[model samples]
Target: MDIVLAPLATDITCAPSTAVGQGGALIEARSDREAITRWLIEYRHSPATFRHYRKEAERFVLWLEFRGLSLDALRRHHLDEFEQFLTNPLPSSHWTGPTRPRHHPRWRPFRSGLAPASRRQSLVILQGLCGWLKEAGWVTHNPFALMRDRRRRLDNAAPPVIERYFEREWWCAMWKLLDPPVEDAPQRSRFLIARRRFLFGFAYLMAPRIAEISRARMNDFRLEEGQWWWHVVGKGNKVARLPVPDDMMTLLREWRAELGLSDMPPPHDDSPVLRALDRRRGVTDNQLYRVFKDGFSMLSDALIARNWSQDHPLIEQLRRATPHWLRHTSLTHQAQSGIELRYLAMNARHARLETTARYLHAENDEWQRQQARHRLSRIE
Candidate 1:
């Protein structure tokens, strides 16, 4: 099947007699592709949702094109086929990507395959898209509403929420390597690595999402009610006043000094909290991800060199680490350290206490040891 590239934004908005797809296939002007583009654009107000929903919608659209159908013509059976495709996308499907850009040969939507949780997420996004399109009179019906697969169901049978985070030992090891002696390397190269460490350190201490960190401005740091706090714009555009630890403030000051800035971040300063290496603008989410990823790789290699087996849980976990895992690590460590749930919830910026309680489920060695007191008696 020929791959379908999305119409450029201007192509959809401009008055055009015809549109083109890959291989010069003629698509009817103002078709389902345009409708899908409009739907995805409406979500641009929320960055996270825009990225996620656009992905699911794009994959679905590509599949529809492969079948030579339009979005309005999709039915329940088509969605079932889509689900199957998501589970194991055909190698030739060209719906995959390391980065979701078109024209990349490695672009399959799924790297390995979607887990049950990921499949549910994809279905939910499409369901919402279809619902919106139906309301707008673009589609005749919502096929997702009639999808009956067990994987698409939202009920008690759903898979457990597994929180991935670093333990205390792992955190310490990362920190040790993240910030080495200033003189250990050339001053120029050392400063660059130090900047990255501060970014990861901010995430660890504040537990902010990568997006929040990316958009974090110096003005967001302020002294409120006699305590230093970061006024972060988190998911859902909700503003959270997270308490900044004293040590973090010290590091901030030190890093700024290294940058030749003022001893403290001025209340009126509008610069990013995490500036790019160029020192002119804030780092993007992708740049921040690469920094943490590089750190994870370095730490994993260090451990392996120290004779830690590749099969060791900590080593293996590091190998699979993503930037968000650091947020989980921070919150989980705080819960383990006996921080009160109510306070931890506020610190974590979790809208619900139950969400924060997920960290309490992190395997507690002491709790497990105490529970081990009860054992079944063996028959002689």
Candidate 2:
């Protein structure tokens, strides 16, 4: 028989249970579910973090339900089994399904089995949860602690090299398609063309994440001390002020005019910078993601129509590109253009310098040049 488990509610808040763990309890949470909920509450202010942590925790709980075990009963062997399960997620009919509403009868814990990187991320989140639970006296031990080389396994010593970004030639080709001259523009509607130009321009120039752009309003862009700045609430609920270049300001003005607004946004105007075609409401992140996906698909079709092979590298890149690739492209290009590392980190809003350093490819180029000197017989 297939196992059925209802996903936890996002707004779950319940009074502490009376049960206690093996250790002297510090938190009031008694059951494993309640304890996990307590841990999730700490990240309530950070929606992205909360959602991610909750998903991993919920999946573990559901897996435990399948095995008829509890968090407190987990051991190194159980942890090992869970790690293996993450890779395959057996009984596919019960564990995997297409995306659906959380409350939908057909909703499943996973859309598919986790990839290696995703599995690592899932383990990292669960490790943190287990540590917290141990501190709260909800569990007797943390199974992650028993694993050898835990630090190397759980944390990346160096940031992974960024590969999911556009090359200059690819970016130029895409821009040509996006911002063709009036005489050369494709059959797309004027409104759509204008929106695409502004949307891509904003993404490439500001390098804001999809959520930041979707939630932005006209008031977020303001003239401050003779300079334009974009105020944004970024990841972890951190607020930042990013400098807006003259070209970006011009683009904003043109986009506003296209929307029938004044050249310069009026002070305190809360209108969304990007809006629905038939309505004034702001678009959701999912909608913005679709916009990028559709744009890439169109670009791919255009290339194919022009005799580009289906298996071309550029075509493959476009097929795999997601909205996040824009941020990667912007940062990587900025690094290549000689932007200092410190400023790049600030612009990217990364907490660590190492994270920003992943975009630096100058060292790789120099290394390649040095390696070229080594040969079976040096050519004079």
- Cα lDDT computed for each candidate against the true fold: 0.75, 0.85
Predicted model with the maximum TM-score: 2
lDDT of 2 by residue, 224-328 (tens): 888888999999999999999887998888788767788898777998989888638889877888898888888898889989899998899898788889999
TM-score, cand. 1: 0.84
Candidate 2: C-alpha lDDT? 0.85
Tens-place lDDT per residue, model 1, 1-380, is 56655523423562442423323322223667677777777767788777767667777777787788887678778877887888888753455446544435444555556777677778777777888777766666787777565353633233344457887887897788776337668776877777877877888888889999889888788987788888888787888887889978987887787677898888888988787766767888878888888888888898888888999998989887889898989888888889999999998887777677778864566779889999999899
Q: With candidate 2 superimposed using the best TM-score fit, by how many Å does residue 357's alpha carbon deviate from the native?
A: 1.1
- Stretches of candidate 2 exceeding 4 Å from the true structure: 180-188, 378-380
- Candidate 2 C-alpha error for residue 278, in Å: 2.5
